[model samples]
Each structure stands twice: as C-alpha cells, then as structure tokens.
Target: MKSVMIKNKYWDIAADIYYPPGFSEDKKYAAIISAHPIGSCKEQTSGEVYGAALAEAGFVVIAFDASYQGASGGEPRYIEDPTQRVEDFRVVTDYLMTLPYVDENRIGVLGICGGGGYAINASMTERRIKAVGTITGANYGRLMREGFSGFDPISAMEAMAAQRTAEVRGEQLRVDDLLPSSPEEARSLGLVETDLMGATEYYRSDRGRKPNGVNRSMFSHQAAAVGWDAFHLAEVLLTQPLLVVVGDKVGAFGAYRDGCEIIGRAASKNKKLVELQGWSHYDLYDKPEPVGMALEKLIPFYKENL
Candidate 1:
C-alpha cells in the first residue's frame, strides 16, 4: 500500500492507495474509490475497513477524505454543501484515472451513508464511473425536503428557507452539532433514542468517534435544507450500473427504499437492491458481522458489473 496526493484547482484530496500484495505497475487493475459519510472522516468508520479489504481483494482501492472534511482540503469547517460534496467524488475519480496501474474503464465507486447520495449524484454527471455501490445509504435531498417523512413538513421548510437566507447573507447558520454536547442536550436533540439508534452509536461511541469532530456547527453549508439537491441529476443515472445496500433497521432501510424507488424509477436497467437482515444502520458502518454481509453482495455486484 502507498499514499499519494491528488491535487486540483478547487481542492487537494489526500488518498491512501492499497495495492494488492506484490502488485505490479506493469499490469493495469480495476480500481475502486470509497467515500465516507457526512460529518465523518475516512479513517473513523467502515470506509477505512472496506477500503483496505477491497484493496487486498485485487482492486486498487483508494479511500479519500472528502474535499472539506478529514485530511482533505476545504474551508468553512464542517459546512456540508451538497454540490461541493458531489464534486469531491468527481475529483477523486479524476485523480484515479491518471494512475498507470488503474484501468480507467473499469473504475467503480462505493459510498457509505450520505456519501451514497453523492456517489449516485456523481454518476449522473460522470460516465467514467462504470459501477456504483452504496452501504447504509441516505438520500440527503429527500431527507431535507421531507424531514424524515410523517414527522413534520412545515418546520422542515421553514428551517431550510432560514438557512438559505443566512447563506446568502454570509451569516453563519447553525445546521447541527456533530452530536449532543451533553446528556441533557442529547436527549433534547432526540438523538439518544429514536429510530436512528445507530446514529447515537456512531457519533457517541468509540466504534466511530473522533476527537476533532463536533456534533453541531454554526454553518453546515451543505445542510440538507439549504444546499443544492444531491440527487438533482439522479433521473439520468441509468447509464451506469448501480448497487444499493441497506440494513434491516427501519431508519436506514426506509432511506434505502426511497433511493431505490427514485433511481429504479429513473434507470432503464442493471440496478440491484439488497437488504441485509438483522442489521441496523450502524452495524453496516463498522461491525464485521453485518459489514461482511453487505460486502458479500457488493463484491459480486462489482465483479459482474465493473
């Protein structure tokens, strides 16, 4: 395995390349680019685990910090603009194509959690992405537009409009704290016990916690409510093969179903949806038992499609 710096005009994305043992530069190999979820870094979750695994599986896998988060370059810390995040995928793909050992034609992508939406959005514009796979995915646009659906619509719209106004005025808008600051706050935020149980685990537990990250921020420029839709171009994404993987848990499963229903409605052919039984959202993020299950479906999908 080796590390390389991939730079572009807008940002410099740091990537860790895992080459199969005894890899040769003379022979081109298929490549896989893995993207981390929102508010998370490459090394903090399942993104790193599967990146190393897939690299050992013979594909040249690269895991990168998205443009603004982790070790990558971006400003206005913790801001989550949907458009910029999707572009980060393109930048990663652009960098990968320049490698001599990578078969640009066979390149594929795997996005975890919110990254899945970006991956799908990227595929809409990037034909170079031959295949795509997502784990415990979420559709940021739908989540923002609908606010967990059946929950509240008026509040969601007001919050979005407010954030948009703030962004336009260059005012720092509070999107969300990375996590609840205290036990009382956690309960107040409703993150402690809800349908998103896995979220509490990921943000609060050592399984995927980080010291540098904060639960809330003044301006998450990419607030689902304020920023551009991650799936705006999804209607035209059928040209590339897609694999959508989800856990059995309600929160994650519901999002997966929504994504599939939207893309499947748009795609012409070559799409798959797999639900991992007995697994919750956080399980697929890092737990070996459940992640292994998700990967089983993913490996075959790419092998056949890519």
Candidate 2:
C-alpha cells in the first residue's frame, strides 16, 4: 500500500492505494474506491482490511478519508454533510480515472457502515462507477431519525439550532463523542445493543482504534442528517449493478433495514443481497470470520461486474 493525496476542490483527500499482486504499469486494471465509515479513517478498517483484501483479489483499490475529517482538509472539522459525502466519491473517482493503469470504464465502489449508504447514493448519479457494494450498509439520514441513540429528535434539533447560532457569535464550537469512551461505560448507560457495545469497544480501544479515528464530530453539523435520506431516488436512478452484504443482527443503527430498502428499490437488475447470519453490524468491521464471509461474495461480485 502506498499513501497518496487526491485533490478535491481546494483541498486534498488523504488516501492509500493498494495494488493487486503482480500489478503492472502497462496493464489497465479494474479499480475500486473503498470508503470508511463516519468517524473512521483510511488506515483502519477500510484501507488495511477490505481495501487490501480486495486488491489481493486482483482489483486495484483506493481507501480514502472523508473530507472534514481524518487527515483531509476542510474548515470547521467533523462536518458530516450528506450531500458533500456523496460528492466525495466523485472526487475519488476522478482521481482514479487519472491513473494510467486504472481502467476508467471498470471502476467500482464499496463502502462500509455509513460509507455503504453514501456509496449507494453516490453510485446513483456517478455513471462512471459501473458497480456498487455495501457491507453493513447504514443510511446516516435514516439513522438520525430512526436509530441514533445519542439524542432525541426534538432535543437534537433545538441543540443544533442553538450551537450553530452560537458558533456564528464566536462562541466555542461544540464537539461531542460519537460513543462512550469504553464498553463498560456504554453498558452502564444502558446501551446494551450489540452494535452500540461493539462501537464503544471498537472505536475506543485498540481493537479498531486509531488517532485520526477520534470518534467525535461537531455537534451542529449533525443537523444535516436529520433531513437527509441515503436511498433517496435510488429506485429511479440506481442502474449500476448492486450488491448488499449485511449481517442478520438487528440493532439501533438500522444497517440491515437500510440494506433491504436499497435492494428493494435499486433499479439494478443484477443486484443481490447476502446475509451473514449471526454476525452483528460491527462484526463486519474487522472480525475475520464475517469479513471473510463478506469478501467471499464481494470479490466475485466486483470480479464479474467490473
């Protein structure tokens, strides 16, 4: 894997490129843009895990950090705007197309967790992306309304309104932890769900922890999610081949339901949904068994489609 930077508007997106075994400069190869989840970075699950795995499977892959977070440049860090999130995929695709060894027509995308929803949403309008896949797909917009545990809708709205206003007045910006500092604290807070528990463990501990994966975000920016929907218009515009891989575990995050909704709505005639029974949402993040199970299907899906 080699680290590189891709231009996005006025800033740069930090990313790592993983070349397939015996890669060649003279040969054009299928490429994939692997996006990490919200509050995660390229070096963790996306770059080192799935990105490396997919590259070894013969596809050149690039794993990148989202803008406004994780080594990427943007003002007022930790903004999770849904619109811009989808656009980030386009920036990555443009950079991928520039490489002489990357086949422009055979590019694909795979996103994990929240990145999954963004991937599907981006693929809807990004015709250059020939195929799409999601593992434990999460719709951040749906999550804010239906699954978010941090704040009730009414309070979240009021808080965001207040914070955004306060920031404009030169008050200190408000940033909050995306999860408890540890699993023990999570359990004490009654966050007993598997996804929540695993999130605290994974993000806060060495299990999946990294410095750039700070697991926090600006408090006011979350308001963008309340009114957004990742699957918006997918039924009409999502024509690329689609694949959704998710665990059977149902939890607060709603990845399973989001996966089902996208599969039912996507216009892709060649789509498929594979369930890894008994694996929870976080299991697909870095766990070998489930990741292996997911890649088994993903490797072939991209291979055949791209």
Candidate 3:
C-alpha cells in the first residue's frame, strides 16, 4: 500500500493506493475506488478490509478519506455534507484517470455504509464509474432526516439551527461524538440495534479504531445532510451496472431496507442484490465470514463488468 494525496478544490485528500502483485506502469489495469462510511475514515473497513481484498484479487484499488474528515483537508471538520461527499468520488476518480496504469474506462467503485449511498448518487452522473457495489449501504440524507433511526428530525433540526445561531453569535464550535464511549455502554443501554451495537464494537474499539477516526459530528453544519438524498432521481439516472449486498439484521439505521430500495430504484438492468442471512448491518463491516461472502459476489462482478 502506498499513501498519496489527491488535490480536491483547495484541500488535499489523503488516500491509500493498493497495487496488485507484479504491478507495472507499462500495463493498464481495472481500478476500484473504495469509500468509507460516515464518521469513519479510510483506515477502517474501506481501506483495511474491502480495499485490500479487491487489490489482492488483481485490480488496483484506492481508498480515500473524504474531504473535511479523516486525514483530508477542510475547515469546520466533520460536517457530513451529502453534496461534498458525493463530489469526493468524482475527485478521486479524476486522480485515477491520471494514472498511466489505470484504465479509466474500466474503473469501478465499492462503497460501504454511507459511502455506498454517495457512490450510488455519484454514479448517476459520473458515468466514469462503470460498476457499483455497496455493502450495508445507508443513505446518509435519509439517516439524518430520520434522526439516525427515527429520533425526530424536526427536533434535531431545531437543535442544529440553534447551534448554528450560537456559533454565529461568537460561541465556540461544538463537536459531538458519533458513538457511545464504549461497546459496553452500548450494550448496557440496550442498543440492540445491529448498527449501533456493531458500530460501537468496531469504530470505538481496537477492532478498527484509528487516531483519525474520532467519529465526531459538527453540530452547526449537520442540517446540510437533511435536504440531501442518496437515491434521489436514482430511478431515472442510475444507469450503470449496480450490485448491493446487505445483512439480514434490520437495525434502526435501516441499512437492510435501503439496500432493497436501491435495487428496486436503480435503472440498471444488470443490477443484483445479495442477502447474507443471519448477519447484521455492522457485521458486513469487519466480520470475516460476511466479508468473504460479499467479495465472493463482488470479485466476479467487477471482473465481468469492468
């Protein structure tokens, strides 16, 4: 793996590029861009799990930290802007197109969780993406509007507006944690929802924790997410080949339903949906069995399509 930076607007996006064994600039290869989940960085499942596996399977892979988050550059960090997140895919695709060893026309994408949602929305117009695969994908806009699990968007928006007003009035920026302090706390609170339970174990613990993945939310900038939708116009514009994978566990985050929605909504005639029974939304993040099962479908899909 080689760490590199790609310029996006005025900031630099921190990314890790993985090359297949015996890679050579003289030969062109299919490439896949891997996008991490919301509040998560490239170092988690995106780069460390799926990215590595895809690279080993003979395609070049690049996993990047979205701008304004992780190791990427941006101001008022952790904003979770849906538009900016979708744009990140295009910026990374631009970088991929410049590499002599990468066949731009054969480029594909793999998005996990919130990243999946962005990938779908991005592919609608970024025709450079020939294929799309999402694992436990959630539409961040939907997630926010529903208050990350039906917690009341109206009340949440009211608080967000208040925070923005306070900041404009010379108050300090307020950052909020995305997860509970620990997995134990989540369990004790009866966060039995697969998304919350597994997220706490993965992002908040050594299983996938990293210094750049503090999982914080920018209070003042959150409302930008409410008005966005990952599947917006997908039924008409999502023409690229699509593949979606999800675990059977239906958490409050509703990744399972979102996965089904994309499959139904996308215009791709070659689309496919795979369900891993007995697994939960977060299980697809780092669990060996589900991950392997997912790649079993993904490796062939990219190879055949790209």
Candidate 4:
C-alpha cells in the first residue's frame, strides 16, 4: 500500500492505493475505489478493512478521504453535501483512468454506509464505472427528511430551518455527534440495543475509532442533504451492474431497506442483493466474519461485471 493524492477542483483528496500481491506495472489490473462513510477518514473501516481485503483478493484498490473531511482539503469542514460526494467518485474515477497499471474498462466502486448511496448516485451518469457495489447503503437525504420510524420529519425539518437561519445570521457552525459518545449515553437517550447503540460502540470505541474519525458533523450539512436523493432517476439512468449488500439483522433506518428499494427501482437487469446473516449495520464495518462474508460475494461480482 502507498499513499497518493488526487487533485480535484475543490480539494486534493488524500488516498491510499493498495496493490494486489505480486502486482506489476507492466500488466493492467482491474481496480476498485472504496469510499468511506460520512464523517469518516480513509484510515477507518473503508480503507483499513475492505480496501485491504479486496487488494488481497487480487484487485488493485484505492480508498480516499472525502473532500472537506479528514485529510482532504476544503473550507467549512465536515460538510456532507451528497452532490459533491458523488462528484468525488467521478474525480477518483478520472484518477484511476490515468494509472498505467489500472484497466480503465474494468474499474469498479465499493461504497460503505453513506458512501454506498453516493456510489449509486455516481454510477447513474458515470458510465465509465462499469460495476458498482454498496455495503449497508444509506440515503442520507431520506434519513434526514424522515427519521428511522418516519415520525420525526416535522421536528427534524424545524431544527434544520432554525440552524439554517442561524448560519445566515453569521453564527459559528454547530457540530453535533452523529451518535452518542458512549453506550451509557446511548441508553440514556433511549437508544439502547438499537442500531444507534451499535454505531456508537463502533465509532466511539477502540473497535473503529481514529483521530480524524470524530463523530461530529456540521448542522448546515442537513440543509444540502435533506433534498438530495441517492436513487434519483435510478430506474432509467443506472444501467451498470449493481450489487447491494446489507446485514440481515440491520434495523430501521438501516441500508437493508434502501438496498431493496434500489434493487426494485434500478433498471439494471443484473442487480443483486445479498444479506449477511446475524450481522448488524456496524458489524460489517470491521468485524471479521461479516467482512469476510461480504468479500466472498463482492470479489466475484466485480470480477464478473467489471
């Protein structure tokens, strides 16, 4: 593995390129770009787990930090703009095409968590991406507009409106934790044993914590994300082969349902949904069993389609 940087109009993306064992520059190899979840860095689950795992499976892989987050450059840090995130995928694709050891025609993408949704949105128009795969795919817009059980939209909208107004009035950006800071805090907030608890354990614990992986994100990000749909025009525009993976045990607001929705709406005749039994949304991030299960299917799917 080697560190590399790709310059985009908005920022220079920090990335790591993982070479397959015994790789040679003389031969072109199929490549995959792995994207981390929102408010995460490349060194987190996406790069440390799936990127390395896929490289070991004989594919060149690149994992990158999203612009305005982690090591990537941009102003007003931690902004989670879905449109810009999708464009980041395209810019990475452009970088891959320039590599001498990468097979331009066989490039694929793998996105974890919110990155999955961004991958789907990117694949719609970026036909150069021949194959796309998503793990625990989440549509941030849907989540922001409608909470887990679809009961918090009004309150959520009101909060967002208040925040936007504050931003317009020149208030400092408000940053909030994406999940509770601790298991006890989660329970206190009535999130015990739910997906939020699992997420807190992963992001706030030794299991997956990294310095740049701080759970905080800007409140203004919601303004941009609330209206963006990852599956917009997926029925007519997403012709590339798609693979959506989710844990069978994932609960409400989990990407399992989003995966199903994508499969139902996508025009691709070659799409498939694979579920990892007994796994939760966060379990797939770095847990050996679930990550292994995911790669078993992902390796062949990209091989066959890319």
Candidate 5:
C-alpha cells in the first residue's frame, strides 16, 4: 500500500491509493473511491481500514480527504458543506477515470457515515458510479433540517439563520464543539451518557478518535436547513445497486434503516440493508472484525454488479 497525491484542479486533495504489493499496473482493475465522514481525514477508521481491505481484494481503492478538511485543499478548513462534499466524490471519480490501471466502467463508491449521504447524492446526480455503499451512513440534509427523531425544524432554521447572519456581518463563526476530547469529556459532551452505547467509545477512545479533528462544525447546517433536500432525487438510484451497512445499537442505525427503506423501495435492481449484530454506530469506523464483515459484503457486491 502506498499513499499518493492526486490533483483536483487547484486543490491537491491528499489521498492514499492502496494495492497489493507488487500489484501490476498493466491490468485494468475495478476502482473504488471512498469518502470519509465529516471532520475525519482519509486516515480515520472506516476509510483507512476499508481502503486497505479492498485493495487486497484486487481492486484499486482510493480514499481521499473531503474538501475543506484534513490535507485536502479547500477554503475555510474543517468546514462541512453538503453540496460541495457531493461534488468532491464526482471529482474523485473523474480523477480515478484518468488513472492508467483503473477501469472507468467498474467504478464504485463507499461513503462512511455522512459520506454515505454524499455518496447517495452523487450517485443520483453522477451517472458514472455503477455501485454505491455506506457504513453507518447519514443524510446530512435530513439531520440538519430535523434534529434526531423529533427534530425541531424551527430550531434548525434559527441556528442556520444565525450563522448566516454572522457570516454576513463578517464575524468569525464559531464551530460548535460536538466531539469530546477525552473519556471524561465525552460524558460531559453527552456523547456517552448512561446507556448511550458505543458513541463515547467511538469518538473519545482510540477506536475512532483523531488528534487533529475539530469534532464539530456546522458548515452546511445553514445551507441544508432551509432549502437543502438530500433525498429529493434518491429515486434516481433505481438503476444502480445500493448497499446500506449500519450498527444495530445506536440511533444512527434507525436512520440508516429508514433511508435504506426509501432507497430500496425506489431501487429497481440489487439493494441490501445489513445490520451488524451487537455493533454500535462508532464500532464500524476502525474495529477490524466489523469492518471486515462490511468489506466482505461490499467487495462481492461490487464485483458482481459493477
């Protein structure tokens, strides 16, 4: 496995292109572009593990930092913009297409967490991607417009509007601190309260924790809160194969299930909703056993379909 830098116009989005050692460059291989979750770099859990696993499976797996985060080139570092994130996937796909060893026709995408929503969004608009999958996926627009299950749209609007006003006033918008820096802090952040399950372990522990990430930033909340509708064209995935992977023990899993149901209903071909037994939302990020299970399901799916 080797880490390489690929240029996307003005931005040099840092990425790692992993392949089996001594892998031939002459063979045209299936390609996969993986998107990491919000605030996570390409080195994080799901992206790092899956990128290596899929490479060993004889596919060219490339995991890149989303714009404005990590080593990727973009303005307002660590910001989250749903629409631009979706476009980042398309740009990555285009970059892959230009690779000498990548078979453009067999290109697929895997979105981890919020990246999953961006993947779905890209799949609907970008026809080049033949297969799509998500692990502990999120619908960015859905979450922003509606908080959790009984999300208050009015509050979401107020928050976004306030942020927009701050932007217009030339005030430095404060990035909300949602991620915990340590185990003790996780409890205070309400990330792991009482029986909240694996979120605390995921974000605070070494499992999913990163030293440099911001843990919280509402870069897209304002845009998504008012007029953004992520699933508006999800029905367009009817012709493409879709895979939804989620942990069974967290609130995110339910959202994954609901989104899967909607896409499954709209999809005309292969579609699967996988619930990893006893797994929690954060467990899927870097944990080997669970991540391996996801790759096992994903590789075969893309091989057969893409």
Candidate 6:
C-alpha cells in the first residue's frame, strides 16, 4: 500500500492505495475506490479494511479522506457537505483513470456508512463508475432531517437555520458530537442501546479510534445534508450495476430501510441486496467475520460487472 494526495479544486484529498499482491505497473487492473464513513478517516471503518481486502483479491483499491475531514485539505473543517463529498468520488475516479496500471473502463466504487449514499449519488451522473457497492448504507440527509427515531424535521431545520444565522454574524461554528460522550448521556437521550454501544466502542474507545478520526461535525452542515438525497433521480440515472449490503440487525434502523428503498428505486437492472444475519451496522465496518462475508460478495460482483 502507498499514500497519495489527489488534488481537487477545493481540497487535496489524502488517500491510501492498496496494491494487489505482486502488482505490476506494466499491466492494467480493475480499480476500486473505498469511501469511509462520516466524521471518520481512511484509517478507520471500511476504508482501510475493505480496501486492503479487495486489493488482496487482485484489484487495486484506494481509500481516501473526504475533503474538510481527517487529513484532507479544506477550510471550516469537518463540514459534511454531501455535494462536495459526491464530487470527491468523481475526482478520485479521474485520478484512477490517469494511473498507468488502472483500467479506466473497469473502475468501481465501494462506500460504507454515509459514504455509501455519496457513492450512489455520484454513480448517478459519473458513468465512469461501472459498478457500485455499499455496506451498511446511510443517507445523511434523511438522518439529519428526520432523526433515527423520527424526530421533528421542522425543529431540526429551525436549529440549522439558527446556526447558519450565527455563522453569518461571525460567530464560531457550532459542532455536534457524532456520539454521546458517555453511555450515561446516551441513555439519558433515549438513544438506542445497541447503536450507542457500537458507536461509543468504535469511536470513543481504543477499538477503532485513530489520532485523525475526530467525532464531531459542523452544525451548519445540516444545510447541505438535509437538502441532498442519495436516491435522487436514481430511477433514471443509476444505471450501473448496484450492490447494497446491510446487517439484519440494522433493519430496524432507518439506514437499512433506506438502503432497501434505494435498491427498489434504482434503475440498475442488476441491483442486488445482501443481508448478513447476526451482524449490526457497525459490525460490518471492521469486524473480520462480517468484513470477510462482505468481500466475498463484493469481489465477485465487481469482477463480473467491472
């Protein structure tokens, strides 16, 4: 694996390229770009795990830090703008196409968590991505507008508007923690116990924590996040082969249901949904067993389509 910096109009994206064993620059190979979850970096979540595993399966894989997050260059750091995130995938695809050892026509993308939504959105217009796969897919827009347990969208929008107003007045941007600071706080907020446990263990504890993986996002990001839609025009534009994976345990959560909805709406005639029983949303991020199960299906899907 090697580190690379992809130059974009708005930021320089930091990425890690995982090369297949005995990879030769003289020969072209299928390439896949793996996008990480929101408020996370390449070193965490599926970016590193899935990228390395896919590379070992004989495909070149690149996992990158989204602009304004992690090691990527951007101002007003940690802002989760869905549009820019979607464009980052396109920029990475452009970089992949320029590589001597990458097959431009066989480029694919695999995104985890919120990145999954961005991947699906990007694939709609960026036809260069011949195949797309998502693990525990999440639509941030929906999540931001309607809380996990169906909070009032209007109140959320009002809060976002107030934050934007404050920003306009030169006030410091407000930040929101991705996970509760403690299990007690999570419980007090009435958050799902399993969701809180997984998130806290992954982001707060040493299990999946990284120096660059901060657990906060700009409050004003709600402006862009709430307006964007991962499945927007998917019925007409998402023509590439699509694969959506989700843990059976997460089906009760909105993200899993959103993934299913996306698949049903996508125009891709080759779309498929694979549910891994006994796994939760966070389990597929880095757990060896679930990650292995995901790669088994992902490898063949990309090989056949791309």
- The number of residue pairs in model 5 that clash at the backbone is 1
Off by over 4 Å in 4: 148-158
**124, model 4: CA deviation in Å?**
0.4
> What is the per-residue lDDT of model 4 for residues 37-61, given as tens digits with 9 covering 90 to 100?
8778889888989999999989999
Better of 2 and 6 by lDDT: 2
**lDDT, residue 254, model 2:** 82
For candidate 3, lDDT tens digit of each residue in 113-187? 999999999999999999999999999888888856256877778888999999999999999898998999998
Query: Which 10-residue span in candidate 5 carries the lowest summed lDDT?
Result: 191-200
Instruction: Tell me which of candidates 1 and 5 scores higher on TM-score.
Output: 5
* Residue 25 alpha-carbon offset, candidate 3, angstroms: 1.0
Collision pairs in model 6: none
User: TM-scores of all models?
Assistant: 0.85, 0.97, 0.97, 0.94, 0.88, 0.94
Angstrom error at residue 132, model 6: 0.5
Candidates' C-alpha lDDT: 0.71, 0.90, 0.91, 0.87, 0.72, 0.86
Task: Give stretches of model 1 more than 4 Å off.
Answer: 148-175, 181-195, 211-227
Candidate 5 similarity to native, TM-score: 0.88
Q: Which residue pairs show collisions in model 4?
A: none
Q: Give the backbone clash total of model 2.
A: 0
- lDDT (Cα, tens digit) per residue for candidate 5, span 1-306: 666666766777778888855588898888888888766778775456888888878788889887777778876666677777877887888888888888889988888877787887788878889988888887766776555324677766676678778877997766666545577776666655421335556666766666644456754345553456556656655458888888776574345555565466645467888888887666687777888888889989978977
lDDT of 1 by residue, 149-211 (tens): 235655655666677687779876565664554445566777654435566667676666776
- Best of the two (1, 3) by TM-score: 3
Model 4 gets an lDDT of 0.87
